[model samples]
Target: MAPEAEPRQPPVDPRLWRYAAASRSFFLVIALLSLAQTAAIVGFAFFTTRAIVDAIAGDDLTGTLAALTGVVVARALLSLVRERVAARASARVESQLRGAVLDGIARLGPGWTATRSTSHLALVAGRGLDALEPYVGRYLPQLVQTVIATPLLIAAMWQADAISGLTVLLTLPLIPIFMILIGLATRSVQRRQWETLSRLATRFSETVQGLSTLTVFGRQRRAADAIERVTDDYRRETMTVLRVSFLSGFALEFLASISVAIVAVAVGFRLIDGSLTLSVGLFVLLLAPEAFLPIRQVGVQFHASSEGVAATRDVFAVLDAAAAASAPPAQAAAPAQGADHRLRLEGVRVRDLPPVDLEARSGEIVLVEGPSGAGKSSLLQALLGFASATGRIEFDGADAASRPPSTWLAWAGQRPGLASGTIAANISLGDDDMPAETIQQALALVGLADVDPYRMLGVQGAGLSGGQAQRVAVARALARHLRGHAPVLALDEPSAALDAAAEQHLWQSLRTVADAGALILLVSHRESARTIADRVVRLNSAEVTA
Candidate 1:
């Protein structure tokens, strides 16, 4: 049967309404503050012009000065309030977005994330989200105020004089129309540039990670040259985006300026003909630019928002990938306890590979003996639910494939995966509550007691020998053993890096673990590993028998 589809996520483009809805109260407050500020500024200009005209007309100076002073004070206070509210709202949105993205990644799990590049993911979480800052703080508030205040301001202007208001209204739409056309033209280019940037980041991360290998092969110069070429491509793409952005800005500015100029000319003619008063003409002149201000600002902000939009697309692409189908819910019944919880692999076949049959009884050792490429490693991975395998894997009469295998199995691979932290932290792997004494005991059991528990291991277990690294991996497995239930242990080439005595002790440790009723399954190329196994299963191209 074909695999079932994974759950679908929302569309790639982030919905602005969703962001507004998430922090509605903050947005509402910001909207009110922005309108208040716009009104105060617009009101200040109107009052100032009125006051100057009154002074020229030999009217009361004291009243005019007091009115202008109040306008200035109110404008300042409203501007400050707008700034404060916007900062808080932007911070809240950024926090929520970061957490949501991380949670989404977590739900997708290692199986999905393993295929993606760390650098690309980093860019999405870091730079991509950073782009949203202005959208939340500045553009969004401006958009809200423009929607609310622009109409009111225009209506007031109409009350002052119908012709001037009409002039402003007709010119307003032209700015946005020009901006939209320019945006549509550049949208595809912006998307391509973001892809190129992500590719560059991924390649740079890979090159840095493999710097040691390149140096060893005497190909560092070639790697540097390759990086330079990619960077040059990235630079060219960035310049294209910059050029388009500048052109868009210039276009919007020119349109707004022309629109304001038209309103100015028409108002000037009215004033000259005595059809409009000085106060009304000044008000219309000030409000004319204000009408086109939001549209022009939006044009500029959209360019900034494009980076985030592109990044969000990449983020959604990862979240939208179909994950491997999980086992059927009906097959997830709990396995029987004690001796019945053993693993049985019956005719387990992997694709383009051989079939192998094996079983491990409780408190027993099942040695998987084979040379390199004998499918021993692949078999272990299949058992751990990392690879798809055909046939049945029964756990105490329950199908192993039906439930999570990690609940009962502990796997130790050849390469010991360690982060840059203390030895105890590495073994516990973020289990902060794990006792230090328990960590020491596990290390001692794996013959790695010499290494300090609090000592820092460099990135990727650097400075450790092959055998020491293997021992650390073994120690990690033992630390897991310290937890309540003794899970089934499966090690691939556990003795490959140990000395004769250490290898003997490691086998003894496995035997000890097995004696405690835990199924111990190990893969080994050494003949000596057979001495510790209760039953040895040999696998070849198409044969598996005891």
Candidate 2:
């Protein structure tokens, strides 16, 4: 296969300001700090040169040494302050970007995330953004220093000695030229390493998630070998990035050292011939290296932060997608929110499925029944805004697509979808207050009352049996409606894992909830569901019926 194409990105993405407001303030603070730091560099160089020359000439040295000491202390203090500021800014930017990425994912909906790798997404939000510390704390500050200090230091040197300044001005461009040439190679290798790491994480996650199935088919060893191969690829790419970084660092150091040496030779020759004063020559010599220091460090920091730069591109892509998705349609007016219990669908067609229409009001149980491949699940998904459909769906006369499902609908899918937490926490998911009475009522409604509310569960509700986990999921959905968070409940195959008695009990409890004034849309293949359902919506490949 041909190599993956490297994505071109700017040194500093403009989107950081838009998505992470902290970055805007960070830039302003960094600009102010860079100005102070530039002044400190000039002061320190001037004072140190003054102190050295005064001692050589047998002049009074006390005042010059004191001034030099003060300048040294100020420079160190400035550096400490800059380090602290960079650290704080790095943390704030990381947090802000991570939040925006998660919110963007929510805005894009499950349909979008379902198409992307969960492992890669986790990496981006977790370790990927965490890498921004070096980028923000070190690389960015050095960049600001280079922009501010390099020119001014050169100007100071020119005022002291013209020849040294001119030499530096001419040769300063060489470091960046070499940096640009080497940076291109560094970015390519670093991006490849980043992509390889993502692939390795994804492969390992998939292997662990399906290890049981792999072992059943005697393919576990093959899976392990595949993971190892991807790991090796990551290791090789990382070594390549390291090699390029080392070569670039050496090239920059060599160029800067050569340029400074030429300035030193000229200064020494001019002084020996009595054409230059010791004070002036010494001052220019000191400032010459300071002029080149910021730019050289910029190159080194760029290599150190290349991984973070690559990750930020991934973050920006997600933020851009969310921005695009959130842009409201020009002709469509905003939906006004109000109290209305009626659920309505008009010509709602999902994928290749035929258009569907239905209406139900409060205190009604609508059972959606169909054979396999009949689009029953897709219908629920379209209503819940998890799937795209071409038609109008309104709840209480407000467009369903315009609002999040949690605002008006509570839902449970075939999977339990539980995280590691207590049973009460699972039932009251999203409820900050965790009302105990409501938790007890919901558990009783779903016949999980005997299950302790405070009992802890493992990942994916591991402690509960399949049927118990399914019932707990049902209770959680019911609890949302009971707690007045949503007015409707959408359940898909909640009884698929239950025995006949439990299934029948679940249908009766659902009927009780419906009688108490909450609308319910249930998808089930069980015939017993129809007995309690006030209305039945039967679906087939060709059409839908009520």
lDDT of 2 by residue, 1-546 (tens): 997776677778888889878888888888888888888888888888888877878899898888888888888988999999999999999999999999999888886787789999999999899999999989998998899889989998888888888999999999989988999989888888999999999999999999999999999999999999999999999999999999999999999999999999999999999999988988898888899999999999999999998898888888988887666445334322223388999999988998889999888999999999899889888877678789899877767665566767889998999989899989888787968999999989888878899999999999999999999999999988887777888999999999998998899899988887888999999988989999999999888889
Q: How accurate locally is residue 395 in candidate 2, as Cα lDDT from 0 to 100?
A: 75
Clashes of 2: 0
Off by over 4 Å in 2: 1-7, 19-21, 99-110, 272-275, 321-367, 371-375, 385-403, 412-536, 541-543
lDDT of 1 by residue, 1-546 (tens): 996643332222344444334567776797778678777767876887888788889998798788889989998888778877888887787777666667656644454466678788888878777877776777676667777777877787788889878887887888768876787756667777877888888888989999999999999999899889888888888888889999999988998898889889989998999988898888888777777777677778777767765665655454443222233356444333344456887888866567877777787888887767778888888877666678898876777755565456777898888778777788887456888888998888888778888887889887678888888887887777666333578889988888999999888888887787778888898888988899998877767777
Q: Rate the local accuracy (lDDT) of all candidates.
A: 0.75, 0.88
Error in Å for residue 243 of model 2: 1.6
What's each prediction's TM-score?
Answer: 0.67, 0.75
Pairs with steric clashes in candidate 1 = none
After superposition, the stretches of candidate 1 with alpha carbons farther than 4 Å from their true spots are 1-33, 66-70, 73-174, 198-239, 257-281, 316-366, 378-409, 415-423, 435-472, 481-488, 495-520, 526-537, 541-546
